[model samples]
Target chain A: MSTIGEYIASHAEMLEAALIQSLPPQWNVPVSLRESMNYSLMAGGKRLRPILVLAAAEALGGSQAAALPAALAIEMVHTYSLVHDDLPAMDNDDYRRGKLTNHKVYGEAMAILAGDALLTHAFYSITQCHKVHGIPAERVLSITEELAAYAGARGMVGGQAADMLGEQGLTKLEELEYIHLHKTSDLIVFSLRAGAHIAGATTAQLAALTDFGNAIGLAFQIQDDILDIIGDEKKLGKPVKSDEKQQKVTYPYFIGLEASELKVKELTEQAKKALLQGGFANPERLLQLADYLMQRDH
Target chain B: MSTIGEYIASHAEMLEAALIQSLPPQWNVPVSLRESMNYSLMAGGKRLRPILVLAAAEALGGSQAAALPAALAIEMVHTYSLVHDDLPAMDNDDYRRGKLTNHKVYGEAMAILAGDALLTHAFYSITQCHKVHGIPAERVLSITEELAAYAGARGMVGGQAADMLGEQGLTKLEELEYIHLHKTSDLIVFSLRAGAHIAGATTAQLAALTDFGNAIGLAFQIQDDILDIIGDEKKLGKPVKSDEKQQKVTYPYFIGLEASELKVKELTEQAKKALLQGGFANPERLLQLADYLMQRDH
Candidate 1:
């Protein structure tokens, strides 16, 4: 049997090839714009959201091919967010994924446009889902709307605004959770839901997966906070304690490290419980993936 | 009989009301982000794009009510583009429509976030198209995809990159045309096409409208160049000669003033010819709007 690690690696490789093909053709206009977009999009990373999308679809017996467009789209959205969040006006980070950031390579203007293009291009990507797998236009449209809603203002952007504002003032635990819920969990929840949606999962199945995604996403973020405090630079692939340096509110900071670790454990268990309760034909791989995410360091 | 100016005025009022209602509700998250978006969206302008969408749909016998969601969506996309385009890293303008720009009223960070939010929210708004007018999910999906593609890298963003890069050196007439075609014409074309799509315009009609829109869009832009050179800044509601200040190339700069005026008249005639040849029922208003756009100072 293929291990979850192998599954993730294979899927990521598949995604990489597909993403490359999606770039503007050589004869396409504005070659430099496409290059700037590709610079950040093709940057190496775990491809966690896309992987989760695939896993969710597989567990629900959906066509992975149909889901591929959405998978690429979410990754694009994620990559765009990273590009924007790393701007000097935002996090001001010079590096991402252990390399110089897009702005660092392409300049601030190009970086901004690159992010804008990626976000806009995501909608174009969703239209391809139907063409690739013979999915209906209506299904693809539903997916398009969902991706935008979660990634847009009322969700991720809103959370980001609150997070930035929070940096200047002391944040309560409730507000921080609010930020985490929208900033991180909403997109993760959308990923699972979108996968299930592609496969035509039942409403209850979709709800359960969303819940599972929420728990795991929250756990994943808390683990990130823990790593920021204690992870080795080589393993983490970026500087640690930058969150502390920024005086940002984090799980480890808001609660003690021990409590935060305990929260991770609790949330992971909750995720597994949600999956089991969902009663899919086979959710073993999803369960394993949840466990893997909870323990990952970088 | 209502003149074209009166027709435009009534449509603009309707669009303004509809757009205001689309802003986030009181309980929505990230109050400041919505404020920033509203600041730009509610700023006064001609509302030309949304009006075109509605007019195109009307000519195709589509329900205005059915087209409301899409009309608002195109407007939102237009507003978002203006906001981003006016940023310090882009056109870097301090004012639009005779008022302070988004970045000027809000900070640069909020302006960027607001633009991002507006772009993302447009997809969410597309989801409501079906609900508003019984427009089919499949049709709405097609519209969503079309909007993204035209507004995206291959279109507007690509043009923007070219426009920015063109600033660094002397630009050829062909290169300047490329920039204008993608940057301005594509979205305008999409706006007309989207409206037709909403009303189930025949393929021939869509193609004709696309050509009509293209002609008008190019004409519209050439006139803008003319205005930038000799038009009053007070009426234009922004600085004139800024394009020259930025050392940007233009139609007037490339071709003499008399020749540029002749070009606008030629293109306007082309737009009317497309509509007539396509057999649009009651093309009078569209024709008038075309003339008005050609002659407008602001």
Candidate 2:
């Protein structure tokens, strides 16, 4: 593709097809359960995490077909997190992406189970990397372990727990960074690493990608906070400044908006530097992706 | 170890220690998240599933050291299910095993995240089969896939969904059986198969154990239904006839108490016969455990 947008568009098509094909057959799952899972999985988002998986793999000379399952798996994990986070017990969001949230559409019970089913099935989907896509079992095992570590108690869930606890009155900058680093960055890191592992990247290369992912993940979050404060309301969808309305502590809350923007630039530059030094055959797309994320308004 | 009770006592102690040790160190996990998980995990159940993993491995001449991680993993999955099942939007229970339910103590949000953390960590725990316990990578992969299958949409979650939908008024025996088979039997079957895979049991032996697991799982459910009606309240740790009080359609509700008891006996016999024909090196403990389950009043 000539542009990052084109690259995302084409890869998203394939990712959508792969996601549908990857679901267990209707006969195998309960009708309502399958419906609830599909409602969330098919809900439109940026599709950034899975696309990162595909781009990272392609950049490392891995075939898209080989990385497709991991791509879908990461998206499933993301979808499950969203589903749970939108529950009445959590953020209690009624809508996401202009549609009813999972718990709002389905009852809380089914939504809870659907989120769970999605989480568990994500691992099952990853196993297909070995079972169907000809990836080595050891590589698949490593990917599975990486996913569990990044998504489990000490990673995304821990970040969420900390964030929730922080919401009660804590205002430390370190705690906010911890939450952002884990709740947002860990899965992004996992996506890149999973794809790189599929391509048999060396330790040095994986470390480089980890640096790239961490930098861009933080940049992405900071940019999101900046947009929430200053971006066009219509383009962004929903209202801007919702964070300020809720008195939520964000990057801009601790640091001024100009500083937050400068930090995003610094992190994006750091990410590009890591990729340039990693000696990959095709880092162009990943470089473009980091820029696309940094500059996007929505 | 001469009796099933003694065998269970010793195995329970070992399983308890393993469960605690298998947890990510306190420093690695968030304090409150760890506390929520530990609360439910240590609240105590029969520890039946993990013990079964140990016993099955022993039957096939595999060491307990090799099976312990898988044992810990299955119990984590079981504990997570209970934590979510007790949520206000689900069963709405305030207590379990004489302790406050997870949501009751930690609040609904933490309870949900804690359950999510436990479920994710279960897969992480299973990966230790190869990492710490020296089981083959391929075996660990298989065990992980089996866990996702038996616990995911097509298995326990599917069963829970069906049971919830059925409570709207459907009372067919077939539907009830479908719910019980998937919800109860799948995990039991996975427990046996995980141990068998660790032991390097042949496909035939795995199939035989599956049959044994299915028979006992259903029989065990029936026994639960029967006990809910005809057993002592104090021994059972809850009121007797609670299912009847709720008008829940259980085995005895549909088949009559006499037929349900008869079905339990026949299923137990079938389970024993499968073990006898399976050519395990030692089936003594599993056999005694089955009979012990059959004869238990509480």
Candidate 3:
């Protein structure tokens, strides 16, 4: 059987083409706005959230075509968040993935607009499930509601706010956990849930996926923190010790590096266990993907 | 037999209460983000868009209770746009409706997060129509789609971008009209259409309202220009001629003051005519609301 890396490599190319096709016509989008939005979106990444969406759907016996729009929508939301976070008033990062950030290439104003446009267009993309794949309107609406819940004030945005606020003071273990849960895990959870909803997963199956998503999401973020200390700069596409330079609180700050690594392994096991219990037609890909994420050094 | 003034005052109070009631609990939203969002939302204005939603629903024999969530959603969208527009990277305004702008009160970072949170939460609010009013999933999904279309990159955001770009060069009357049509009329049209959709308006009826919305939306904006040059400062709650100070292109800039005033009257007449042609259980309130908007100094 092919490894998860082979699966990801094949699917990522499909996603890249689908994203370009999904953009509204030039007449619909203004010339400069379209250019700015495309600039950041076309910049490549791991496509992790969207890949999770496809994997979950496939595990539940759904077609990838049926899940493509939702996968695209979630990616747009993720991209928009990154764009906004890199703004001068926010994280103010000059680079992402070894490339100049959205605001660096486009002006701050256009970057802000590009982010807003991407976020808004994400919902528009979700609606395409009905047109493109014949997903029921009821199911689409449910997905839309859940997406807004996870992406909005009470979800990722709230977490970013908490993280920013935490920057001014000492962040306790519990507060850091809260930030990680909302800022990272919430969207991850939504990605899984959206894909499962498209596949008509039962409530119990959805619960299992949620648990699996939460565990892996936290593990993924912890891995990010651990990588900051010991990761290769060329592989990471940015310098190591960024959290240290910023004096940012991290898992490694609270727990020792070895303990943090242990936590990631433990969470990965928990995630795999949840998936095994999920009773899917095929969970091998997801199980392997979880292991793959944990084993990655970058 | 009461005047439109009384109609506005009575409905405005109900809208104010509903807006406050619609906010998510403190636990769901971070403290600073909530404060920044509420700061701009509660800064009172005429409540024209939400009221139009109610008016259109009523005209088609629908209950206000059934349309409140959508009304609230549109208002949130409008308020979020104002917040983002007031950012230092954008319009850089210090005040809105005579109160400190969101960024002025909350730091720039929180203000940006607040705007993002608010924009996202608007979709969450729209979903409430299913829970609060028992609107069907299909209808709600359609409303959600239309809302995204009008408020998204190709809609209001596109208009804002065009307006910004127009600042660099001489703006012809056609370009100015394009800006006003999308920037102002699109949301107004959506507001009316949303209410009509909730009320089960026919295709013809929706078309009539769209026409009416476009005419009055332009007229309303032109009135803004006229007021900038000739309006009372206290009534407007801000300095007059600020548009002139910015050297912004306005209707009066292209057509001259006397012609601009005549244009408002002409468009107002056309709007009233469209409403008269629209078949509805009751159109008196909407008809009067249109006139009220035309006659307002602020």
Candidate 4:
């Protein structure tokens, strides 16, 4: 692995540990609800969102500790979305990450509540971070506002709605782009932008990070689509052909595999360029992240 | 209605208008999620939670506008809990306030997402309120922390879990009290306490209001239990006797209806006394609220 990749992998392991440790105590939740939240949140995945926050903060000359809460908050929000997405009425997936989805394990009611709890707790987490770092309350509030906007109706939820509604037929490239941008890209953008904002980034730097995040987020989704069709079920830790079975529209379905791959390459390059313009002299880690995202086996 | 009651009712009406008018534009959420959130939020209730915040603030000699956002935040959190509770897995209720529950109308996925959105947005609202009121950032951060603790696992969610588990059988009065104290009473207490905090309530006043809130909240729950057994469905505007159908444990179930009614009366008296001790001479509105809780047909 490249040096930056190695660093991210190690950092991700630590971040995951922190996340699991931070989960609501079993005593605090119904036994069933606690089990369900753990089922999804503790399920092993690359801590991509949190890693993005850490990486962005690091790139901006901020300490990882300074960004830890933002990292945790982003992951919490992301996990919440995933938990809700796997519910019977949404993606209806029975299995995720090689195990039963939250609703299947906890029942629908607890699963719903678990997601709500996580989302609410995320903001709670962010506020606590504000306290610890002595970050100006206005800046913390600004970040909260930005994070809410991106993760809420206009951003991720909106994308999921369009995805569900648009499931009936093959979608155009523009529609697919809209879905990726809102669903996948918005939080990713927020994660990076929040890190920079917390670290007192200049307006121009914030704008650049936004562009970089947007490109990488879309590219990440495109790669995910490509993997679903070609990835190994055992390695992917879930069913490979499930999206196809559900007839969900994806970048590969619209642009063909080769075209999607090309788009991923193009977006990766653009993300790198944005990072460069944003005065990231030590772009090694971020560049490796883009490469690793595009080339992941699962 | 008494003059204070008339004032509360009128002010609550105004708060309701502000809530409706203040909903972030539909464009902020995807059309589907937007429809679901609005359906439940705009479906009218007495606006008791927000009104409590306003009254508490006014009583403490703060401007009502200073408390509006906090009031709105409390309602959003309360509404989110309701949406999640009515999901298929939780209470599995089909209707609330005589209208279809969020999941039933919007489908479970959107309902879940909508609830998550509302909870997250609540903090954003509070922060924005602080900004508008020019409250110190540290104060805003502290308020957010207080709000989170009350709403999160140790507060409302914990109560919910106990209520759900206790539904199987809560034979003791204390167990029922524990459940209500956490689930129903904590937020009510938080609502009053948070308002008092924002208004710079004296330490003595804060302690008294906290006591007052705790007494009334339990009384409120006890009255709800009484209504479930004795209330008219048409007047309640929703299903009555649902506790029996759901096999849920309640105050009346443990203490008997007559004892529960007596408890409500006692609690109301305690609440009024606490308010008086807190130096609230104009306890007119609070007394009316206590009475309304015990005597309302609905």
- Give every collision pair in model 2: none
For chain B alone, what TM-score does every candidate structure achieve against the true structure? 0.97, 0.97, 0.97, 0.94
* Winner on DockQ (1 vs 3): 3
* Model 1 chain A weakest lDDT span, ten residues long: A20-29
Q: Over the stretch A1-298, how does candidate 2's per-residue lDDT look in tens digits?
A: 4788888888888788777766767547888889999888888777899999988898899987888889999999999999999898998888776789998888999999999999999999899899888898888999999999999888899999998888865577788888888899999999999999899888988999999999999999899889989988777665778767877799988989999999999999999999887899899899999999999984
Residue B121's lDDT in candidate 1? 82
Q: Identify the candidate with maximal lDDT.
A: 2
Per-residue alpha-carbon lDDT of candidate 4 for residues A165-214, written as tens digits (9 for 90 to 100): 77887447888888889999999999888888777888888899899899
Q: Tell me the deviation in Å of residue B126 in model 4.
A: 1.6
Candidate 3 per-residue lDDT, tens place, B1-298, comes to 7788888888889988888767766557777888888888889998899889999999999978989999988899899889888899999999877888998888898988888888888888888888668888777887888888888888898888888878875558998988888789989999999999888888899999999999999999999889989998889888888888899888998989999999999999999899888888899998998888788884
True contacts kept of each: 0.85, 0.90, 0.75, 0.65
Per-candidate TM-score against the hidden true structure: 0.98, 0.98, 0.98, 0.94
Tens-place lDDT digits, model 3, residues A1-298 = 8778888888888898888766766457778988888888878988888898999999999977989999999999999999999999999999988999998987888888888888988988888888678898878888999999999888999999999999976558889988999999999999999999999889999999999999998998999999989999988888899888999989989998999999999999999898788899988888988888887785
DockQ per candidate: 0.77, 0.86, 0.79, 0.61
Residue B207 accuracy (lDDT) in model 2: 92
In model 3 chain A, where is the ten-residue run with the lowest total lDDT?
A: A21-30
Taking all chains together, the TM-score of candidate 2 against the true structure is 0.98
Off by over 4 Å in 1: A24-27
Residue A289 accuracy (lDDT) in model 3: 82
